[model samples]
Target chain A: MNLKVENVSYRLGKKVLLDNVSLSLQERERVAIIGPNGSGKSTLLRLICGLNKPTQGEVLLAGRCVHRYPRRRLAQSLAFVQQKANTEDIVRAEEAVSLGRTPWIKPFEAWSEYHQGFVEKALLQVDMQDKRHQYWHTLSGGEQQRLHIARALAQNTPFIVMDEPTNHLDIKQQLGVLSLIHHIERTMLVAVHDLNHAMRFDRVIVLKDGGVVAQGAPETLITEALIKEVFEVESRVIKSMGFASNVQLIA
Target chain B: MLVKGLQGVMKSHPLLFVLVSTLTLSVFIVLGVAIGETQIDFQTVVYAVANGALGTQYPINAIDQGVVWNYRLTRTLVAACCGSALAITGLVLQSLLRNALADPYLLGISAGASTGAVLVTIAGIGAGALSMSFGALIGAILAFMFVVALAALASGRRMGNISTQVILAGIAGSQLFNALTAFVIAKSANAEQARGIMFWLLGNLSGARWQEVAMAVPVLLFGLMIVLWHSRALDAFLFGSDAAASIGIAVKRVQVVLIFSTAMMTAVMVSMVGAIGFVGLVIPHAARFLFGSSHLVLVPACAVIGAVFLIVCDIGSRTVIPGQVLPIGVVTALIGAPCFALVLIRGQRK
Candidate 1:
């Protein structure tokens, strides 16, 4: 499914949160959205996921307005992993992951092995299969974040939208999650804070002051100039380990 | 022992678990009917019910049969309905609002009902035309509307975290209504009338009758069905409303419908039985501790456990003080407060 945000603007009272922000994604594409704080990255993700409506424009999926379809139908094709989602409910790791099957299951439908298969696969993907029976509160912050990603993965949607899925992870787990996203046969739109990590995605969209400043292939768009302009930091882009481009912030 | 035994049954066979729960409710209802002020035997209570329900010609005292069939049975059934409805409301509110302390009375329904009943009884607001229950129902609806409006006003532009605003508004509305009730009673009521109104406010089932049973059961059933139908959506709310919406739930629609339904069910139960406390606040947590947090299991578990808990409490109210029957609310609080503390302590340890 192709996801398109056409001239979306969200305003809260007199303050403009997102102004005329637009982007489009092709099927099986991996796009990273990077922005300074208060640049509306989370707002854009919420709009695209249909958790909130765009004030002036609309988000469309496969040529239909995203809000036109029933929430269940929309969710069957697009999964969302929220940033820093937490719950007070006492749920096991596997039980929490099983909720990803919600869009697929009817109200009284029996949870068949087919559904359970996705939960197991998701747990394995996040490397939390060993802790499937553990309580959610017992998990560390990074592990909790992984479970959130695993929940999105278990939804089995073609388009997955996540906000800072790697926020709390250490370097090893961060790379593991990124690599997993890279290899998956799904279209992914992820908001990331790490400019270095953002450089690896197939495409990058940079936002500053509620609008898209630049977007395109990582190599072409993420030059030293764009980083300094958008992020307000002196930085250099260099070839790291032969095949990868790395961004190093200059002091 | 029962909680552990139930855990084992829940893990092994879902059908057997349901059967066991239903049996427990039935047993409690029978015990509630039998062991009242007049000690009707268990067989006699069952026979009286059969006679009343099926026209069975059982040779029993007319007074005993009448007491069992008309009074105790109706009281116990109404108590069960109130417990189930209140617990379901609590579970739904806690999950939807993401507040652990949410309960049926948190929306100010109980306080409103108390005020309304007081007005009708002492102030003679209805001039003997409106019954206390009807007045209470009206008050509950009015108080709920006030809370909703206050919550909306407080939240204003940012509707993101309205649940907290709602909790606050409910607190304010409850305090306001409770003050109104106190003021009215203090101003107008004589000692005898004040005493009666106070007893009713503390929760009384002395007035529960067949008519009440007829009213309460269907409301409970309807409320249960609505809640069970939305159990999946309720589970989605574990992570909050935004997460629930992202997972295909129509968060606003579900919230409005469930909240309205639970409120209506609670209003009816409160008017019928004077706002029995603790079942709503404690039973869901207890159920979650025994069963898992999945609403699919939690809903049924709460219904059964809540019914049994209230039935047992009703029995305690009748028999605890020898000749004089204590108010049902007092018994529940006397028992529930300690049990709730224990639940909190156990939860913290876990």
Candidate 2:
């Protein structure tokens, strides 16, 4: 496993944010975490990404305990993309993207041509080539989302973790971002609100009340009964759409 | 647009702009020395610098040397150092705290320093600049520690001080310290002593000497070097704390380093010359308007511009009325507040 979370638990004061969650990822594998709000998907991702410490167990990256790895080394191995990357800074789009090269650059050193290449290629991949010089705050919400993903892409880490990578994107841009993520050759652990996006993943982890309710290949774990049991909502899994099937949810 | 033009020039030759600005400040120093209460000639000022007192190019007087070197030169250098120190502190603090309004004084250092100064003067514990600066440094450290601890708690013990809690804590801390200083002065001092304490509270650069400059310059250089060394980590902080951490920055360590350096600089500066407002508050924003938020460019720009601003304000304070000195703190707020407003308006329009 390129990345492993073994029996991790987290408590925010008295609230058990996550309870004994375990998962593993192979090289270049894509896994989606699907759950309703307050189900610990984001918290689990946060723990795995080293943003928060787990109360129990540990996260291992590249066969080393994550806590033991130096911060820059950990950042070089994994990149995190958020749904919204908010900043008080009034900076150009290209400058914001260049921040991804920070782990590679040393203190007081300028970003090299090699670093700029990564940023340029990522922007091009996101189709934000023309908006490179534009102010980040002025960009549309969808554009901003793409730019942030591009920032993660620029990091060129082997493991990528995202929380709602498709939020704020239009339909075309949504698919575009997914296709972009899909085409990238990396291990992806994504928390996705859209079940359609999750179904396309190689595997899915279903979360409920801060516990792992089910985990399997999406086709097996994503049955209507499980959805009904967890979300308390009726859902129908229609066939013929492959893993990208329409999982219709009714109120 | 004026700033845009300057930025365009800066984009191509940032070194040249910084050098030229430094050169401009050097000329301002000479002018500041030359055009004091006595209004000596530029030629004589140059002669005093180049040829010394005994055997000059043109018969220079002892009074001229005394006024130029003993008074103006020392104050000018202090102003330059103060400006650079406060401006760079503001730049680093704003980035570290992720607050646009963060400045050297925002952490309660200035208020605490004032309290220390008042205590010393009223109780007659220590006289002279050295002991006064020592007292102020002690007071500043106390306030800085308290505010930082409060901010850290408010941020849920997170390593970074970027939370709104730090700012709120600082505001409270400043009010408490400022009130304590005021109460000490009002209650303890006789009329003459109170007047003197009041003058110091309004900010003062009078009686500036080479010793004060000697004390401030090394710390100023040290602070600048440390900030320059941590420029990349500081850039990481431009994004919120979580993002900075995700990128592998030791955010807690960086925040502690930044807090210490800025507080140290502010303590030294405020102790030497009272808490001159607005340089730390507004200069970084003005520098940002010219150069984007990249600290590599922004920090240098702030240093140069901030020096020029304080020196210019110093000149105004010197010449505003015939021999009646005005507190520099007054002029900086009077000027810096409007400049900051203009920057906000222009930014919004852009």
- Name the weakest run of 10 consecutive residues (lDDT summed) in model 1 chain A: A239-248
Query: By summed lDDT, which 10 consecutive residues of candidate 2 chain B come out lowest?
Result: B50-59
Q: What is the CAPRI rating of model 2's predicted complex?
A: high
Model 1 interface CAPRI class: high
First chain TM-score, candidate 2: 0.95
Best by lDDT: 1
lDDT of 1 by residue, A1-251 (tens): 68899999999888999999889999889999999999999999988998878899999999999989898888899999888889876678888898888899999886789999999999998889999988899998778888888888888999999899888788987888788777767899999999888887899999989999989998888899998888899998997676779889999
* RMSD list, candidates in order: 1.9, 2.2
Q: Write the per-residue lDDT of candidate 2 for residues B261-297, one digit (tens) a residue.
A: 8788888899888889889989999888877777877
Evaluate all candidate structures by whole-model CA lDDT and list the values in order. Answer: 0.89, 0.84
Q: How does model 2 score by TM-score? A: 0.95
Residue A136 of model 1, lDDT score: 92
